[model samples]
Target: MNSHLPTEKQQKLKQLIVIFCILLITLLFAFTLLIAEPTQELSSFELDQQGQKVGSGPTEFRIHNQQLYVAVPSNGHYVIPEADLKTIRMLSDDIATRQIAVDQKHVYCGNMILKNLNPQTVRSIGDGYISDGQVSYYCSQITERNTELNVVQEVWQILLHHTGIGSKPQSYWYPHYQLETSQSPYQLTVQGTVSNGEYTYFRGKLVEQANGHTMRYLPSYSGSSDRLRESSHYTADGTHVYYKNQRVPVQDHPQLMVFDFGGGIESEFLHDRKTQNFYYQTSPFSQKYSPYHLLNKDDEHAHDPLFLSQQGIYFYHRQEQKLQRTGDNPFSQKLTQLAPDVFHNGQDTYYLGLYDKYIRSGRGTKLCYRSTVLYRLKNAPVNRWQKIAEVKYGNSRWRAATIWKNGAQYYYFDEFGQGQGFDQAVYLIKDAYALRFILNPSRSSDDIRQYAGRGILLSPQVERLAKAKYDENFCVSELWSQNE
Candidate 1:
């Protein structure tokens, strides 16, 4: 009835609005396609209640692929070629125990049951490594690490009870032919081997042949109380020096000579009764390594074990499994050790600038030359030493610059004159304060408060240097200034 009324006008407007909205939606959809980014396929897997994936990376000892291979548990392990991956879960939550584990045959990783390997007890050794009662696993592959001295001894005992060294002991179920592994849990070797009832294990690995009857530990020094120090362990059977069961080959070693361990200048040393070629840790030094009481053997250095080779004082260092020259400054001429590390040429004390660890002699920095030293004693380099003050009195003159170690602390003073004699001598207490004396030199010992560091005292500064005889780089006088 109202078809021809004004309501028809409203209907016409509504139709136009709907058509305009459809066009706007179409434009936005096309614009979105133009700027859309490409997306990569997402990695998907089921996780346990603890939020750990049952099989993900090598950490789980399970590889993920398009084919769903599942690990199933039993008295022994089984790898199912076709199974739902979402049903599996890792066993433990601790990241350390994230590797595949089995309880008798209930193989587990997070919440997933693994293909059973008849695991007794699985232990993780960090970095995706796992070891079970039967074998060790690494990166989902068989591997071994080096064994420690103590662990080698312990593992050998387990082998001895299970199998005979040359032959398997009478057993009910199976004859043991197992191999041992090292600490790496991956490197298994049978070299220089030893055996137990189960397998011929070096430490944790099974070897083809080794001395089965002899004990694996080092014999105590005839006079010592303990067996041996942990870091410095050495044992020998007939052919090699074994440090934690790792072979250290020796050349020119006599069969009849007895091996005796001695104190190294820095660490424990190895000595043979018949020869002077001593070993520090696993390293062997030259034959020139003289005896402790050999006074005539001045050719060898006792400290750091330096020796004369090709007319140069070469230090013996075993780096990368080889001995080579490695001294900051090997002396050019033949010198005698008058003190511990202090060498003497005629009456002169060889100056080893700051590189020389020994500075108590005052040779390099005790006004001996003209420079305060740091690091190991070395010859004072040019420009390293600068003159900061100068004073001349009668036949004696003194100069002061820089600071050198007095004892535990460092101080600056004059070599010729007393520091107290200066118009306004400034003594700095802390290392940060004395740094200014090196950067800036004042002719008249006066303190600028801005530059004067904490613990500044003028009078005691001079007296301390004079009494302690802290030297200047270049001074005509050896004694402290009398003006104090």
Candidate 2:
């Protein structure tokens, strides 16, 4: 009797309660999804003692122990670790708008800070340099600052004049000048670097003995007009000329000549008009010997002028830097020219001459021309003397003065025809047939003399390829052989 069916009002209230509970549960599920954290599929990594991630991330940085690391996030999944940090400092609360952060002791850009730099006075001076009140930094290395150091004003003007406002100076260092600096720890970009009235610098290092006020780029010795040419390799500071930073002893800057005879020609030379001295610009010659005197400017002259030093008489090759002493002087008042280039010293006979060959390209292929000197002793085996090559045609004959015939080969001397006691001529032809038959028995003397009477015709290619065999030592032979 007490338990009876509920009335209509009670039943409605129960239905309402059930509906409210369902709505609350649905809202709770939606809220959980909205606040869910984004999970990235990262490679397995360890945490440092401070509970910070060990690797580098674009958004996150970590420094543990002495080594610092940067994390670059990859495709939103993992991070690659790399570091080019210079100095370390405890970071501050907020990153500056330039992404540069500052702590009490230092200023930092990402993971790096300048070494031993005071952050209070750090300011951007123009050029590819940063500066404090005292010293300047180029590529992060300290270059001594002089009182006359005035890079800031000029750079600012250049920025306003050339690059317009709001542009950075570092962007213009390399492209505007196309500087090709030598290998240096500081990554120098500016051509010839920045100079003050009293000091000059290159590749972030000071140029010794350089007068920055009058410093200028020298023209190319190879006849290039471009003074700003990166390969010109010469600069002068009013009083002296510097080649690739090394000072040339000769102080006549205006009279200094640096010539690059392309190919194997002459190993490039530096001529000093003031002293009338010629120097080899390349190594070995420049490194070892003093400027030498070249006698007989005539290329046709057969005898290499005696390289007479106070020490003794020396023998040197046309294309080599080495010199050898003959111990005894061969020249005497009685010395006689028996033939066109043949000499007789009463007891000994001498043959002296010149030959032509092609200079090689950077690819190791023949591309240019050079004249080589030929010297030898021709007392025995005259029959073996052969005319392997000759200069028959073109202005090269007179311009180079390279005539060819037969004599002893270059074997007695070194590859460069340098040594003592030239006994047998190697690969030279007798220039004058009348004198040739006097010693050579194999050839029909009558026929050679007859041919000589008619006069000989020689071609340029004949001299070029005749003595042009490249040896293992990179020396070209003085005469053409059948193997060539």
Candidate 3:
């Protein structure tokens, strides 16, 4: 400006510098604003006393209040403060009592005895309310007597008396009492006696006595061989007994008789040696065939006959050779398709087998194998479908595996693999799909091999599911019943 340069050039340079500075300041301010903006908003119901964000969305009641504020959604109340908040104390005494009362009112009370004859012997009493005026009273009288041999024989004369002003007394008494006596070195006799006031019920002095004979003392035979003679094979349910492809009668031998799909047909076979009749009951022909018995003649033929889920009875017409579905029988209902083997997770989800079609290529020709697939049922319509495994080979192959919901994951082999694999290694499925390959040595080893595995295995998620199902106790028999 002082004769160093022209006025217009200096002015132009100054103007350019001013414009660049203004542009830089503007960009810096914009960047600062972007960084200052919060990623998530504070919950509507929760707030910090210092007007700072504590938690995202509506804050839930929390144990810590030094850094985060907690809001209880139920009553729209703040449970914790941002700072200076002590213990959460989620539930008060009154709240706990109210919750317990609600649960008692709505939940089912199993096997509850309103008027128990003897509370001393009652191991468990369900939750229920008793009126203040109601009272249960039991009294028994004992008479003492001495025998000539000076063996003090005390006569027990129990008299139970109850007083419930307007209620009937509920009593369960052992009317016929028997005393065990030593007969000899090889035998013991149970002497049966009736109460003094009661009428004599025995047919003879030594009525219904079993001597310790070699044959009588011998363990009772299960008649399994007899069962085999009647029918080489039996259905999953014991109900339908069969002998040599014919129906059998199970009236006299109920133990030998099994419940075939709901009393369809009974057949009998005679054994020459024992003259013991073997019986078999054929499952009723239904539109829905048993999934467990998918390898059966009708099932192999893809007849699509209906069968009872619990009973395993099939439904088919002999003349038409066509399968029929009818609700007339108590066992099954009319349906296009039956539900797959179902296993519950103790929540809204249920693991089920779904029918799927797979193509197998043999000698340049392709054949379709109509098999079952696994699916997870959720609360929504679009339930998750989890492809667990498939039966690639073998006739009358694996049906569906049974899941054990305990502290850890366990699965039972399908009907085909039953009594085949090692007890420990025989588990059908695992929660982790990868473990299936590790357990099955026959399968090839590769990264993709993990996907080829089948059956249940131990896993943290599976353990959680098991704990949920068996919060109290679980049963192995019930799990095996699924195969039956």
Candidate 4:
């Protein structure tokens, strides 16, 4: 035991070694804490459907209950889109007012209302470009198209000026793409790959793949262009696929089946029909919808392109995104298009949604209504329209033969009758789902006629369009976290 004892220097060296070891360990642990990012909580990555981290990179994003915040490379900040949320890039802050209107519906732009304007009757001979008796509204501005004087080759939002087809078709603004075009849209062949003269255009711009000799624009899969194929949706060269205006690398296998959302001008829901893959401007895999379509079209389960699937008559939900199954859609069966967003369903005429002020499609509760009496218009300004019988909602037992309109018609359907027996009826109008009927003006106004129109009195004020209310059946994000 006495020999085992170390010398004075040996004892000092041993103590130094022990202390060095402790300090090394402490330094290593401190360095690890610094490098590992003590603040990181696994939320730096965009989450998958299972709430698991999917991918991580320098890209910035914010995940919250109501929004999927993403960093805009241009602005370098995460911001929420105005409405569609899908096409955040193309949409301006005021794009909320860029809506498609049904007949007799008001056109709201920002804070102003373009009264007496009808989009379906534009002289441009297209659904969007209409010339109503009220006023003319082109895509961008209140410009007029001389369809009688010139033939429109294409109509794009970007194309400001055109030389007309009668003029030399060499260099003119293509109306469809809204892009200046040396090649006519009518001559650009079915495949977006067609090169006129030497250049090819897509998405209101030129295709970089255009080599003047071989500009490819056909899918390797089996299909032809639909009537709406003029827009640059899923176009492929022999090598790569282009979606929305960018190149989809060969690995993505875009040939499977292309699904487009909204329209050619505003394509937000670009996805694969087979794989249910979704895409955005920066990330190829932005979101996903359900893989299968249960209801054909009217069946409602999975037929709409905007990612809105019907669970019931009104209950709608998005398969993988933030939007959940919202209950209630008034219109059922094969809905006919009386105007852009207005549908003529079996016997009811209902507003498509609540966001007329905003251009969103799949949100807001719809109005479902029915009237027994009807008269198909014989000499009405617009053809093929049948006005339904009006029903009042206020403190009156007589619910039929009158509608709520502004200072123009004979009767006012007291729309918001609280505890007035017609509370349910009033709720429909108060909720912006009022079913209004028209009076047969040619008929007589007798004093004894109480159920019938006594005279053409000025219309009374009705309820205003309701604010957008999207009541979800079940929130997926909240449910997922709770289960975890």
Candidate 5:
């Protein structure tokens, strides 16, 4: 029995040794497999609309809301749609599509793939504006293909100037509805006025010699007019001065003052207090006129350019070289040319003027008044001036009439309405959509009768002028908005 027990124990030991060797061999093989190749779970994308998998080989796809978004190598150039496997859109074959940027309405083709932009660094600034650091892309609303507006170049940095009071003014660049949303909370109205550190741009055209660092808006008494193209805006840098991007020359910046007669007539006349020089449309008048001495020097009306004196009435206008004389002063008191050709005589007001209506093709819209000029005559009788109608509203009363006459022909007031007190030229309620009309005084017709009755007349000439093809500069000038 002892011999049998020893033999069994030896067999058991041999069996244990064999089992240990097998286990060691298995562990060694597993360690070798782990070191040779690492295990990672790779993502896979579905087929595109064309039934072909997009992007180059070994590409990893990103799935967002069941949509397949993939970042491909520089050599891959296809955009895939996950909703429908057969709706693939192919970019230019030569383009190396790099990245995919997904917005609600657009999936961007990395920068270099379209319009020579760099995809690696493309980013959105604000208000549908995107940039690759150098070039700008201005999208009106959605940022889809064929909807981008390439603005300027060499834009490493963008500076938005807010003309509004609170945080900033609302941006006119984007749609009005998106202005206050969380996505776009900045109040910034570019209005074709933007600046970098080196240059200032208006409507994408650079203002030459204007320092962008110092460029700021020159605010008028009535803010900005609704006319985007022809508003009376000014900006100045360290040494240069610009009025709506046009250079304005003045000896001293402090001495230059803008004298506007209200009613859309803004920055038309500039006066230099240091030199006593008057500028019309930024051009110096040939002569200067000094104020006349009055019994009451303290009276504000006595300091006007046109004041009554013992030597008759002296008038100043852009058409004359000197202060033109208006014969003898008929009125006993000092006369103030309240509204261009309209004058007040303390008790009754009189207008002795002529009509010269001009239109700027595409500029009369909401918040912007009409454009017209009224020229006052030298020697005219006050008795011929007659009233046509009276407009009364909100504790205000205004009289409209034919303030001048040539003979049997009576020239009546056309547009007579609100201004500081009242503008004898522009009617606040009338919208003329850039049309022209003429009244023939020689022929006593319906036009003249309408002119005499309601001070409003329409002619077929309006349609003709509207159809007439005029250049962008047809009636464009610094004096373009002459609503006297």
Candidate 6:
């Protein structure tokens, strides 16, 4: 073997090297093409199960059973079932009334009588039915009740039907029954008198089996005072008699007084049924310095002292309690100052509404509002706060606030500034769980929009939309998907 290669061998080696280089370049180009393609790209259109191209938008798109549905802003609703193109027939120009209901047996639609006849024909009822619209169908006398019709009118009532034997009225009517219970099996005779006064002893039989009974007592005092008072007692089936201005906490004692707190009850007297711990407020009538001065700077009165957790009874006291001096008063406290309207969601989490601002708390952590922000508390002990959303309050003003569901959802009412005050509209953002809002737009300048909207929870089965990662600065407009 010679150290130097021949000319022919060198040429062959050069050709092989060129071929290997070309192959390597081809593989590299193919790999680059795969990586360059965007993983998150906006789909132009989608196809149905029947290969039909559905329209596209930001919303999550899906096709089920060859049908296409779209999600959009329909009267404040984000998602709606798409109308069937085949069943879009105009049966009649005149609109017909239809009633809808669902039961274990079948889904009912159309008029009450017609729905009863053919209960199974009802399909998915759309939201459009709520508007002034019409539906049509062929009439059929499915039962004998349809053939016979009679109408009558009575004073203070309108009788819609009368069939010689019975009658039906437009308004509701409850039948009354008065049965003599003296002859019944369950009967008892008892005699009793008041301990304080020597009142007259009346003889009366207690009917145990009767549905109910009313007793009218006219106790005439023979003494000097000219004042006369009459008290009547009503017993249901000779048991559980309710007396005026008195409540019986337990049964078997007809004459007993239950615990009653007179006027000035504390504001934080919350009854925790789950833990059986009764949280209440104590009166500040005896204390020289008002609790108001300790908690609130304003002249407003602090009626009741609230007990927080296992900590001793907390009141706005200047010298007695160290927590109060440490700015733990209800008004001056940083937590309450950040959120005046506090809502505890029966769990560790709490929603705070500090004047116009909003915040959330849990364990030992607190988070405040900056813009349209959402905050969540970190896990216990070493609790911390985290930001969720910087949503924009599009066309609404803050009204009231509420925290519910162990801090799962923080809801707030937004005054739509429609001159209707607090009843104008409500805006709700489902924190990081689901980004959504409920809007009730006013019909006119003077009309008020009350509870007329609901936030929708996007489910995969119902709406196969792409899930977005939690973004603290996401807006309502950004969360809304219009695809499919």
Q: lDDT: which candidate is best? A: 2
User: 372-458 in candidate 4: lDDT tens per residue?
Assistant: 111122112223344334443344454333343322222233222211222111112221212212233333223113221323222
Stretches of candidate 3 off by over 4 Å are 1-113, 121-250, 254-484
- Alpha-carbon TM-score of each model against the true structure: 0.31, 0.31, 0.18, 0.25, 0.34, 0.17
Candidate 3: worst 10 consecutive residues by lDDT?
462-471
TM-score-sorted candidate list, best first:
5, 2, 1, 4, 3, 6
Better of 5 and 6 by TM-score: 5
Model 4 off-target regions past 4 Å?
1-227, 249-265, 280-289, 292-352, 356-484
- Error in Å for residue 25 of model 3: 64
Off by over 4 Å in 2: 1-193, 217-233, 246-248, 259-270, 278-291, 295-374, 377-484
Off by over 4 Å in 6: 1-165, 169-349, 352-484
TM-score of 3: 0.18
lDDT of 3 by residue, 63-124 (tens): 23354333322222222222232321211132111111111112101111223222222111
Candidate 2 shows a clash count of: 18
Weakest 10 consecutive residues, lDDT, candidate 5? 460-469
lDDT of 5 at 471: 21
The better-scoring model by lDDT among 2 and 6 is 2
* lDDT of model 3 at position 145: 21
Per model, how many backbone clashes are there?
A: 54, 18, 41, 23, 14, 14
Q: What is the lDDT of residue 277 in candidate 4?
A: 46
- Top candidate on TM-score is 5
Error of 3 at 242 (Å): 18
- On a 0 to 100 scale, what is the lDDT of residue 365 in model 3? 31
Candidate that beats the other on TM-score, 2 or 5, i.e. the better one: 5
lDDT of every model, 2 decimals:
0.35, 0.39, 0.26, 0.32, 0.37, 0.26
